[model samples]
Target: MKIKKILVDSLQEAIDITKSTYGDKATIMSTKIVKAKKWLFFSTNKLEVTIGIADSEDFQKEFSKEKELYSEIENIKSTLKDVVEVVKSTKQEQKTPPPITQVQPQNNEDFSLRAMNLATKLINAGVDQDIARKILEDSCGFDITIGRLDLKYEDDYQSLIEGLSKNISLKAINFSKNILSILALVGPTGVGKTTTIAKLAYMYKSQGFRTGVITLDSYRTGAVQQLQSYVSLLEMPLRVADTPTRLRECVGELSSLDIIFIDTAGRSQYDSVRLKELKHYLENVPSLEIALTVSTTTDERIILDSARRFSELGISSIIFTKLDETLYPGCVLNACIKANLPVSFLTFGQKVPNDIELANYENLANILLRGLS
Candidate 1:
C-alpha cells in the first residue's frame, strides 16, 4: 500500500488532492487539524489528511475486510439509534397497522371473483410502492390507503402511465454535424454494455456514417475480441486503447471519421477506483458524450443506485437494455422519474440492429403500458 499525507485548508480540498493523487480507491487513514499562529492576533487551522492506496490485490482485499468491519459497526450503531427512537416515541405515538381481516374473502368463491387492485398492479408491475402511490396521488389523485383498494386494473391505467412518463426526458444520438462525435458507453459488469455498443455501431454504420471503434475494454476476458467480431462484421476499423494516453491517440487517429464509438470495460459501480480511472480516460477525449447502459431487469433500488454512482463520471444520457427479460419493466420508468436523466435508446433483444429503438415520450410510456398493462 502507498500512504501519503496532504495538508489543505478544508476537508473538501483534502479529498480532491487525495483523489487526484491516488484515485477513488484511496483510504483516509487519519485527519488532523493543525492550528498555527500566522500573526500576533491571527491564527489559521490547516487540515492534515493521511490517505492510503492499496498497491496489490491482497492489500485491497484486506482493505475491503476492514471497510466491511467498520460498516458492520456503523450498522449496529444505527440499529441502536433506531431502538432509542422507538422507545422514546412508543408512548406518544401508538399507530399500529390494521388487521388483515379486510383482505380475507367471506368465502373461497368470493376470492375467485376478486382481481388485482390498482396498487397491486402498480407494485406487481415492478414500480416502487412509494413512487407508484406518489405518482397516482399526483396524477389521478387516488387515495391508496382506502381499504384493500380492490386489486384490479381499471381506467386509472392511462393516468398511471402518464405519471410514469411525466416530465421524462429523451436525448437523441449525435449525427455528426461538423467534427467527429465520440460516443462512449459505460456501466457495471454484465449489463450488456458491449452488446449495446455493437448495436449503436451497427445503427450508425447503416446510416452511411464513416464509423470507427475504439475499445478501453482490455480488462475483461474476450471483451476486445467480442467488439472486434462486431466491427469485423460491419467492416469497420477497430482500435484497442489500454491507457488514457493510448485513448487520446486512438481518438486522434479516428478524428477523420464521422463517429468514433468507445467501448469501455464494465466496472462495478461500487468500485470508486475503477470509475475514477474511467473518468480520467474520458477527460482526455474531447467532446466525448457517454451513455450509462443499465438493465431493466435489475431492481428499481439498484437501478437508482447505479445511476447515482455512475453520475460521478458525468453521463450524458442513459441506454436501457434487456427489456424482454422482465415482464415488469416499470423499473425503467421508475429510474427515469428518479434519476432525472434522459433515455437515448432501449434494447429489447440481442439482435444487434433490429432490437433497439430511440426513446421518446410516446414510445417510452407506451413500452411501459404494453408490458405492465
Candidate 2:
C-alpha cells in the first residue's frame, strides 16, 4: 500500500483525487473538516488529501494551492448541487415507503395473518418498504408467535414499520414519567459535554426533579467554575471531585437527591488509563447510568471508536451535541444504532436547555428525513 497526498478545494475534488490515484482499490479511511483553515481532509491508505482555499504549500512551492481557486470553487458548487439533489431524491423515496403486502406468503394462514398484521402496523407507522419486507420475511420462520408481536421492530423491519409505531414510541417516551436516574457524561474534550449536561439538568429540573450536578472534571482549570456558572444559572448545586474516591463520596453525598448527574473530565476514548480511571469511579456508583456524549460533527470512525472504547465503561445511552453544525446527522444515528445504544438526547444549539430533544423513534426518523432531504 502506498500513501499519497492530493490537495483540492472541495469534497468532489477530493473524491476525484482518490479515484484518480487508487481507482477501484480506494477506500475512505477517514475525513475531517479543519475549522481554523476551512479545509476538508480526506485520508486513505493510498493518500491524505487536503482540499482547501488556504495558502499552504505542503502541496506546492508557493504554499498556496491556487490564489485563483475560483475555478475549483465553481466545480465544487456544481458537484455539491448534484449531491444535494441525489439526497433529496432518496429522502422522497423514503417518504413513499414502497408496499410489501403483495409479496406476503399466502399458504401459511396463521403465519400470514400475523405477518399481515405486523405489516399493516408497520405501514401505518410509516416504516420504509424495504424494512417492512425484511421484518415480514424474517419473522415468518419463528415458531412461537405472540412474543414476536410485542417485540419492537427489529432493524430489518424498521424501514417497513408504520409511522404510527414510531409516533407511539415517541409519545410513550414523551408521556412516560421521568425516571430519577443519574446521567454520567463521558467523552473527549470540546465535544460540548458541559453544555449538553447543562441542557439535561435544566430539562429534568424544569419537570420538577431535584436534579444535582456533580463534576469529576477537576483536572481542567475553570472546569468546576464553568459547571458552577450553569449550576447557578439553573439554581442547582454543583459538586467537584478531585479523584475517583472523591467522586464516589460526591455520589454518596447526593444519595438523597432524586437525580445525580456526574460529569467526568473529557478525554479521548483511546486514553485507556484515564477512561479506565473514570470507569473505576463510576463502578462504585452502583445504579448510575453512563450517558456517552459525542459531537455529531466528528468523523464517523472517531464516533465508532469512542463508543467502542467507552463500552468498557458500560454506556447506557448516547447524547449527541453540535447537531446544528452538521448538514447531515445520519452519521450520529448510525454510530449510536451500530453501538446498540439508545439515543437519549440531541443538542442542536448553544442554548442552555432549549436546543435539546429527547431521542425517540419519531425524533430519529424526523432527523433522518431532514438529513436525507
Candidate 3:
C-alpha cells in the first residue's frame, strides 16, 4: 500500500486529485482544513487530504500467503506454550491440593480489573476523565462476578454510556398541529448557525411542511445573502429581522407557515451584552424553541462553555456542526453529557440537508466508540 498527503482548496478537489494519482481504488484516510502562512501576518487555509492506494494484485497475494504462514507458525507456538503451562499446572496440582477458596478472591480481583479497564477505555475514547471516573465509580456496588462480566460486557458498556448520554437534556422543536412552530438558532460566531438553519429549512421543506426562514443576523456580511440563496433554492419565504420588534412582526407574518426558523446573529459567548440582546429578541416571543448551534470541531471545554453561556438564551436543544472536520468526534458525547443538553441534529459537511442528521443515542454511541465512517 502507498499513502500520500495532498493539499487542495476543497474536498472535491482532493478527491479528484486522489483519483487521478491513485485510480478509483484509492481510499481517503482523512481530510482536514489546515492553515498555512503565505507571508508574514498573512495566512491561507487549505484542505489536507490523506489517501492510500492498494498494492498490486501479485503483491497482495504474496502478502496474504505470508500472513497465513505467519499465523500458522504463531498458532503452533501458542499451542506448544499452552501445553507446557498445562503440564506445569498439573505438576503443581499433584504436589499441592487445589485451593478450597478461589471464587471470592478471583471475583474481587476481576471486578477491580474490569472496572479499571472500562474506565480506561472511556478515557481513551475522549471522555472527560472526571466523567469517566464518576461513571465507573457509580457502578462500583453493582455485581461484577465473573459470570456477569462474561455476559455481554461490551453491550453493557455501550448501555452504560448511552444511559449517561440520556441524562443530558435534549429538546426538539415542538411543531404544533394547528399553529406554526417557531425555532430560533443561537450560537457563537463561526459555529455554522446560518448553514444549520439552511439545512433544517431544506429538511422541513422537503417534508412538505410550509417552511419559512427569518434571519436576525443582518450584522454579519453576506449572512442574509447566504440564507436568501437557500430560501430561494427551497422556494420558501425569507424575512430579515434586524431588530427585536421586526423579529416579532416577522414571526407574526410567517406564523401561518407550519414551521418558522429564526436565525440569530452569532455573538461571542463572553459578550454578555450581545448575548443578552440576542435573548431580548426572543424573550417576548411565545412558544418558541431555541436550538443552540455549535461546532463539534472545537475543544470539549469550549463546547461546554458555549453551551453554558448560550443557555442564557434558553437553548432548547443543541445542533452540533462540523462533525466531519473533527478528529476527536467523541467531543459530541462529552459536550452533550457535560451540558446536559439533548442534541437536535448533527451536521458533518458543507452540503445542505444531506450533511445533517437527527441525533440518536444509538448512532451517537457508535460514533463515540467506533468513530465516523
User: TM-scores of all models?
Assistant: 0.60, 0.55, 0.64
Candidate 3 per-residue C-alpha lDDT over 239-312 given as tens digits, one digit per residue, 9 for 90 to 100: 99988999889988888888888888888889999998888889998768888888977777888888999898
Model 1 gets an lDDT of 0.76
Pairs with steric clashes in candidate 3: 169-340, 169-341, 169-342, 170-342
User: How far is 165's C-alpha from truth in model 2 (Å)?
Assistant: 6.3
lDDT values for all models: 0.76, 0.67, 0.76
Q: What is the per-residue lDDT of model 1 for residues 1-373, given as tens digits with 9 covering 90 to 100? A: 7878888888888888878877767878899999865887899888888988777785778879999999999999999999999898995554654443334333223321122244456577677776656544433331235433232334555555555455466788767745689899999888988888788888888888888899998877888889988889999989999999999998888888888889889888889999999999998688789899998887767778889999988897989999888888767767877898888998899887688888865665566556733
RMSD of each: 37.8, 37.2, 37.1
Query: How high is the lDDT of residue 237 in model 1?
Result: 84
| RMSD over all Cα atoms, model 2 | 37.2
Off by over 4 Å in 2: 1-180
Clash tally for model 1: 6
Q: Give the per-residue Cα lDDT of candidate 1 at 5.
A: 84
Error of 3 at 279 (Å): 1.6
Compose the digit string of candidate 2's lDDT tens values, residues 1-373.
Answer: 3444454556677887777765644545555544234336844332336433322334354324454486689899999999999999998976764343333443335344545666555444434455444444644443333422222344324542343233222212231234445778899888988888888889888987888899888878888888898899999878988877887778778766678788888898879998878878888776677878898888878988999999998887778888778765656545654677767777888998898988766566555444423
Candidate 3's displacement at residue 233, Å, is: 0.8
Candidate 2: what lDDT? 0.67
Residue pairs with clashing backbones, model 1: 115-151, 116-151, 116-152, 117-150, 117-151, 117-152
